[model samples]
Target chain A: MKVVLHIWRQSRPSTSQDFGQDGKMVRYELDDVSADMSFLEMLDILNERLTAKGEEPVAFDHDCREGICGTCSLMINGRPHGPERGTTACQLHMRSFQDGSEIWIEPWRAKSFPVLRDLVVDRGAFDRVVQAGAFISVNTGAAVDANAMPVPKADADKAFDAATCIGCGACVAACKNASAMLFAGAKVSHFLHLPQGQAERDRRVLNLVETMDKEGFGNCTNQYECEAACPKEIPVRVIADMNREYNRARIKS
Target chain B: MNWMLDYWRSSIGGKVTMAITGLLLFGFLVGHLAGNLLLLSGPEAMNEYAAFLKSKGALLWVVRCGLLAVFVLHVITGIRLARENRNARPIAYARPDTIQASLASRSMVFTGLSTLVFVVYHLLHFTVGVTNPEHFTMETSAGGHNVYGMVTASFSVVGIALAYVAFQVVLFFHLAHGVQSLAHTLGLHHERFTPMIKTASVGVAALITGGNIFLVLSVLLGIVEVQS
Candidate 1:
């Protein structure tokens, strides 16, 4: 199959002012793309071709290529990943595109996730938000018995559902406001549903949310774009749960 | 006391503020619509209803003040949040697209501001009687501000009636997105209940729009008229 790609190309900016302004779209025509190839594999082919031609290869982040790592990030054709729901850019196959299609690819757009290079933005804001409180502080000792603290089946399911979040910025990317509420909400709800997460409940909600705001993310307006673009299909209900948790924590404190 | 202030300053706090105020304003809308519906019963009923509200004196003033406070807070917080949201993404998408976001969901600021303008126009036209002083002076047999006379006189002007209809369209979009958002901010969500909540949201929008539009069209079409 043949496809034309318009890819965003830019070198890292020395100052914040030069971030998005320095990038431009560079077009590449690929005639030998295989329908079975993963999106990342297709990129690899493009890179090999660029390398042989003594041109700079496109810079994009990817690891494990299996969609679990949350490293492969791209805004393919204006969507967080691509046209498919519940799928990441790497998991998307070339077969999704029609022959002779023209594709537009760019890095995730957000002030917090500035483009470091072509098609690669810094998502360290997510790590900082997690570090704020998205964890338990249990002592490192012998493993505790799982059944000792019996959790309700419903709570366990909700917790497990939230725990699947891959820390990807797709929610931020897809959101009109670039809000991280869904991501931070999932983290908050993941802990709120279990006994292990009870100790830091109030503190976690306050810290995680405050940190998210400090990182220059926008507030959620209940548009649900984040839920739709989420590669793991995290529900917007987690966000409502997070709101409940935040209000509860505020009142208690 | 300090915690309350702190809560108001946070992001979630901002949304909570908007949600609470929005709910109050929505309540006011329903009440206001119900009051206006008295116009269907004729000038006597509508004017008497207006006189009844005015009869409360101090209580009426208190309710008006409270409604004003809620309206001010809603607009202020909404504008501040929108500015921050715009700055959060300094760079715009080349080919911006939405997957599931409705036009109403995306254009809240525009629709909200349009409604705001319409609100001021409405207050000037009816409450202050500044827009049309001639019709504003229309008196009923009973001594009262003739709200029924004012509405009929205003709707008789085709331009004014059409403008009312257009603003109703804008208000409909704002209310549809806003009512559902209030539920989300208040943590009201369940898969089974969401369908109902959504239906109720759209239903409220449709009802308000339909009722208000019908009132204007009724006067324009002569279904209801000022008694000769």
Candidate 2:
């Protein structure tokens, strides 16, 4: 099948006036794309073609093509991870596209997630936020039995749901304001639902939320765009939970 | 106090502040609209309601001052959040699009600022009576302030009535986003209940805007009029 690709291209030299300091969309036509090929595999084929033609290949991020790793990020046709909902770019197949369709692929857009290369962004800000407080502090001694600390079924389910978040920055990419509340909120709620996370609960919310703000991410306006674009289908309710935790933490502190 | 200041400085804090103040302002609107609806009950009820409010004296001033403080906070925090939001995305998408963001949600800042301008004009026209003093200087036979006469005289003019209706449309946009935002900001959400909340947000906005527009149209269409 034939697919016309308009992919963002940026180099370290940054000499192109059309692409700006970061880069701009460069067109590539691939007539050999197969329906069975995953989105990353399609990119691989494009790169293989570019290599044979002695041209620079389009750059993108993908670790595991299995979709569990949030390393793959792309704004395909203005959507995070293409049109298919609850799936990553690595999981999106060429079958989702028509034979004669034009595909526009760009990097995740956010101030904190600057475009490092073509379709690749530096998501170090998410790392910094996680480093701030997405964990529980515990003295490592003898290993405790997981079942010993029985958690409520509802709470455990909610925690596991939140734990599915892979820190892809799609929430920021999807948000009109580039808000990371959905991402940060999921992190906060993942811990808050556990008894083991109770000791540092207040500190966790405060630090994660503050770090997210300091990273220049915008506040949530309840638009639910993040949820819609989330590959994990993380609910906006996590954000509300984060708000609740932050308020409770504020009052307690 | 220092902690309070710190709380207000956080993004979540700004959100909570906006929610609380926005809800307060919404409450004020509900009351204001209810009072305005008294116009339909004839001149005596509308004017008497105005006089009753005025009769509160110090209590009325207290409420006004509190409302003023809330309004200032809401506007200030809103502007700050919006500026931060703009900065968070220095570079925009080449072909930006939304999967689910409503038109009202996206245009919140514009709608809010427009409503702010409309509010100032509204106060000048009615509350302070500075914009149209001739229409403002009406009185009832019972020696109470003639709010019915003022409202009727103001709305009788097609242009003035249309202007009020225009502002009501802007206010509708603001309220549409705001009412639901308040619930979310306050950390209130349930999977079963959120859909209802979203619907209620629009419903409440429609009711408020509809009531206010209805009053203007009522006067304009001569359903309600100033007593000769």
Candidate 3:
């Protein structure tokens, strides 16, 4: 199928190379593209054409096309990763688009993740946030018997639900204010639900929120756009839980 | 105010403050709309309404103080939340671009700050009689003569009227988030009622903005004359 591609292109990161200023929407014409091909795979075809013509290939980030990696991030058209809910760029198929539709594709826009080359971003900030002890930090000794923990099924389910967050940075991309509360909440809530996590729950929420703030993400206005665009469908309720937990920690401190 | 100190210490406190102040502001909007609608009844009606409040003396003062406190808490908590949010993600993404936020949600902070400025200006111009000259005009009311004429005269100014309309629009956006957030903060948002709350917030914001615009226009257009 033939489609018009509006891609945001920048050669370098400088005041002169800013988006909308340095970026131009380059149009490409492709024929016989498979509808079943993933969105990133389609981009690869476009880049291949550009390279054949000795033109610079468009730079984008993608790995593990299975969508579990959460690295294949893009703002397809106006919605995140096309119009489908609970999906990533790599998971999105060409069949979602009309044959002749004009698709506007761009990278995630947030202050915390700056463009490295083209579509690639330094998501290491998220890793740093997690490293600031998003975990319980229990030493590995005799593996604690699973039955000894005796977590309720309800609590275990909630914790597992929160733990499903893959840290894709989609919540930040979807939020207009660039708020990371949804992402931070998932990380915070995942640990707070179990007894093993109880030991560091207070410190975890505090340190993570503090780190998130230090990272320059915007505040959650409770808009729920983050949830709407989250490929994992992590609910904003986790954010409320995070808020309640943070308040409790603040009082204890 | 000190009791509110505990509320400011945590996210829940912030959430509670957001909810309580949000509900108070909602109530204030209803009352404000009711008062402004008196303009549709002619100058005497509006003036009598204002005069009735003045006659309450200490009671009016108490109500005014309460509203002021609510407004202050709401703004302070909002600012604190925004600041903490900014702190959470200090790094800029390499290709960070957003295409999902609604205008109302995205402009919340901007609209909020603008509305704050408008609120102060409004109080100074009409309530405090600092910037508005017509606020000094006197007129006869049910209890006696008072400053009803001044309000009509003040509303007649195109500059003031336009400013009020613009501010009211900002207030609309603020309320959009405030009303919805209030429900979440209070744990009133559930699967069955979340959509209802969002719709209600939108309707309330529209009604408040619409009501204020009507009063401002009626006064400026001379549709209602102030009784002397």
For model 1 the local lDDT of residue B202 reads 86
Q: What lDDT does model 1 reach?
A: 0.91
| TM-score on alpha carbons, each prediction | 0.98, 0.96, 0.78
In model 1, the runs with Cα more than 4 Å from the true position are none
Clashing residue pairs found in predicted model 2: none
- Please give the RMSD to the true structure for each candidate, in Å: 1.3, 2.3, 5.0
Candidate 1: the clashing residue pairs are none
Ranking of predictions according to lDDT: 1, 2, 3
Off by over 4 Å in 3: A12-25, A141-148, B1-103, B107-114, B117-121, B130-135, B141-170, B185-189, B203-226
DockQ of each: 0.82, 0.71, 0.27
- Model 2 chain B weakest 10-residue run by lDDT: B219-228
Clashes per candidate, residues 3 or more apart or on different chains: 0, 0, 34
lDDT of 2 by residue, A166-204 (tens): 889899999998999999999988998899889889889
Candidate 3 residue-wise lDDT, B29-81, digit = tens: 79888877776766667667877888999999899899989989889988988
Taking the tens digit of each residue's C-alpha lDDT, what string does model 1 give over A130-196? 9999999998989998799999999999998899999879999999999999999999989999999
- Highest-DockQ candidate: 1
Candidate 3 fnat reads 0.25
Where is the poorest 10-residue window by lDDT in model 3 chain A? A14-23
- Residues B1-228 of candidate 2: C-alpha lDDT, one tens digit per residue: 888888888999999999999999999999999888898899888877888889999999999999999999999999999999988887778777789999889889999999788889989999999998987887788666788888899899899999999989989989998999899999999989989999999999999999999999999999987543
